[model samples]
Target: MTDAPQTNAPEPPPRHIESAALLQGAREIVIEHAGQCYRLLVTKNDKLILQK
Candidate 1:
């Protein structure tokens, strides 16, 4: 074994954001059509919403 020099640097995570995971978020949505009410389940990453 040989001694090698190493640099101390931080590495960024691959795929920093995921779309599927967004569905499991803390958000509320309200929809009304005719006589039906819909509450959409959605999540967001920073500013992008996973569900409409």
Candidate 2:
């Protein structure tokens, strides 16, 4: 009996950023993509909401 060889590759780690750093004291920020505008908002409950 012969064993098969493994050829698995390691994955790169994901990037992380703090919400405070991204928002920079702003309650909301706009993001533009594909000629469209989107809003990223910090809600009253302190949750994030994305809208187009």
Q: For every model shown, what is its TM-score relative to the native structure?
A: 0.29, 0.68
lDDT of 1 by residue, 1-52 (tens): 9978887887877766454454355465555778777665543444543232
Q: Roughly what TM-score does model 1 have, to 2 decimal places?
A: 0.29
Residue-wise C-alpha lDDT for candidate 2, range 1-52, written one tens digit per residue: 9899876978779879898998999999998999999999999999999999
Top lDDT prediction, candidate number: 2
Report the CA-based lDDT of candidate 2 relative to the real structure: 0.94
Candidate with best TM-score: 2
All candidates: CA RMSD (Å): 14.8, 6.6
Clashes of 1: 0
Candidate 2, residue 12: the lDDT equals 78
CA lDDT scores, all candidates in order:
0.55, 0.94
lDDT of 1 at 15: 67
lDDT of 1 at 47: 52
